[model samples]
Target: MAVVVGSYSFLFVSTFVAALTYITYQLLSSYLHKWFAMKPVPGPEGTYLFLGDALMFKPKAGEFFRQIVEFTQEFRDLPLFKIWVGPVPFVALFHAETVEKILSNPVHLDKSFAYKFLHPWLGTGLLTSTGQKWRQRRKILTPTFHFSILTDFLLVMNEQAEILVEKLEKKAGKGSFNCFSDVTLCALDIICETAMGKKIHAQSDSESEYVKSVYRMSDIVSLRQRRPWFWPDFIYYYFGQGKEHDSTLKVLHSFTQKVIQERSESMSYGETGSDTNQGQKKRQAFLDMLLKTTDEDGNRLSHQDIQEEVDTFMFEGHDTTAAAMN
Candidate 1:
């Protein structure tokens, strides 16, 4: 009787395992193979079930981006191509017409679903925002970037540029050191000053906690985006990526909150809700402008709203631009 019971249990477990495997394969293959057949543009062939090309980064983040670049060049003749980011298909276009068509369409203004991950970091600011709120926010923030305002920011830009050059001069002919790191620091410093009317001195203090967290958070977010298994919040939070993300958010948000509070307190003393320093006329920073400005309905933004925009611009302004320059 005991021998018979053991055999039955073994059979049941094996059957269950086989069924689960078969089901997963069928679901993965159905979409992948079907999409492969349907796509006009070429893409990675016979991808792994849920991983797509994500596994190619194994052993390390590896040369995954180089592989994509090579793939793009390999199919240079094609106007566009598809790439599966963990079963999610993205169409990459190289042709001017194809890019223009997508960009010019008002209907396609919605951000990609991947941007959902940014909600904790950026909130629903301009980059991730859409529909009515987006329209209203865009209207209010549009003039903040006007030519005259940007002209004021040029001095900040030049000052940061000079500091970068000074740093680079010391490294001249001192063997091969990473130039990307220095340039990124310079960009961060410039954006901090211009965006918040605060100087982070990131270039001088490269090991600052806030600066280090920014770089780490960038890596963490990129890694999370590439892996589909990490997409579900329950799984991500269970495995502790969520905690790391939250910790990084504290670093980023606290810094921005401090900047906003410092500026807010300064503005509180002024009847016009603006600040003056050392008896000299001070130019309004981005946060100051946002605080004084209102939406289409003439409603002043709440502290939460201002924080969202401040965090969004800080991330977009510094991180994206720095990475691009590097």
Candidate 2:
């Protein structure tokens, strides 16, 4: 009986070891092949089997975006180069021709895998959505931004610009207190009024929870992008950055959801069998337009869809205006 038990345990242990060895060998072999393939591209030679160029990435959140630009400068002679972060390959093209060749193709319209990082906050909105869903949403929303619609927004722009100038006037001689901040606040105010028809007064209330959460979320995203170790959702969450991220998302999404809920309650214009605003000639808010709008197939956006687009608009517009100002 003792001999029988020993033989059974030995067989089980051997089988497990053999399976593990085979799997490890297969993974290493595939990685070696991929590494060899990337060698043809002009990039840092003799890349490590695992870490790749991840160790070279800037540790600071602000400089995370500059890594690609620095690579371009360092490898100026190469029109195209590969940046390996861990086992992932980031192929960068410098020449306009190479970029246009890929970008100009409709089949390559899908956002890269990295954009999935934004999915938790942005959802499948236009900024991150792909395939048929993106096609349908884009078709529906594109007309909303026509020249005529833009012309209508000029009034909101002028109003916000005036407020921005006034704010700057107060700090005219304060000795360089980050004027970039003034621009961001003004941009936030403009987006809120123009898009949601609500005045968040972000210029004055910079310390608001929603505002802080937005900035925090932005920082967390940059940190996650550069640190490949944080790329896996399971590991990220296990370490609690994911929880922190979710907390920020909750704050940000609450604001958007509140805006959506209020907009829905106030107007029945887009919804079937709902009363329209008392026939007033008020300028349309972007949210109002989207609320009462439909696609070519008579499909109105779902509640979640509206929230995603609104949040995306807020995120995209706020950061862009700040970057431009700086």
Candidate 3:
């Protein structure tokens, strides 16, 4: 019995070593192929072999985004340039013709590899989905964003904008202030209300757990994207900010799920009741439209589907719109 156990252990060890070696070889070969293929693309000089341009990426929160914009401007004359983030290659397109070529082709519709970091929080929502799923989802959601349908949410946007103006007015004549956070919070309020039909009041109550989780999650995801070592789930969770990431994700997903459940229940009740409230000019939210939306086969979106789209909107809408507004 002892001999048999020892033999089994030896075999397991040998097999594990062999498997690891094969995987390493395959990955290295793939990276080499990609590197050779992109050799024609111009890049910054003096990039490290293993680290690539990763060391140049600032570790601070917003610096990564700023540096990327700076790099693009620095190489604006080039049609496209390549940057190595560890083994991964990032090709930046500066020419309008090059970008137009990619966008005009349906074959190039898949999102970038960096978007994978958002899968934990967003699932396979419209932002991350590819192939047929993306086409189907886009078809179902196109009507929701139509001019007529979008007009319903104007009230929420205007209300949130007024609140933002009021807050900024108070700070007026006091001193120069960074209004980024204030503007982002107002955008958050508009997005939450229009997307979920739930008032989170982010401007008035930024300390709320849900609000904090949203910001924390964004920071954590951004950090992971810049740090190649954190690409692996095991490394990220055990060695990095795994616990905080998970806890923040729980808070975000919990809030979204709870809101979805409440909205679904209320929608059912509304369908059965009299159309009294329907007579009033009540603002219809994206969630309300999603509940009624159907696919080409007349199939309703699943609960998870609704949640993913809501979460996608919540993430995509606020900060981007705020950035533009600021």
Residue 172 in candidate 1, Cα distance off native in Å: 1.4
Against the reference, the lDDT scores of all candidates come to 0.81, 0.81, 0.87
lDDT, candidate 2, at 96: 89
Q: Residue-wise lDDT of candidate 3 within 1-326, one digit each (tens)? A: 99999999999999999999999999889888988898888887767766778878888777877877888888888888888887788998868899998888889878888899999999999999999999999989988898986776776788889999999999999999999999999999989988888889899999999999999999999888878888889988889998899999999999999988877898888842111244666666888889888888998999899999999999998978989988
Which parts of model 3 are misplaced by more than 4 Å?
1-16, 271-279
What does the lDDT read for residue 109 in candidate 3? Answer: 72
Backbone clash pairs for candidate 3 read none
The whole-model C-alpha lDDT of candidate 1 against the native structure comes to 0.81
Q: Rank by lDDT, descending?
A: 3, 2, 1
Tens digits of per-residue lDDT, candidate 2, 206-322, equal 998887888889888767765778898899999849999999999999988998888887786543222224773466677877888787778787888898889888888778877
For this target, which candidate reaches the highest TM-score against the unseen true structure? 3
Q: TM-scores across all candidates?
A: 0.83, 0.83, 0.91
Residue pairs with colliding backbones in model 2 are none
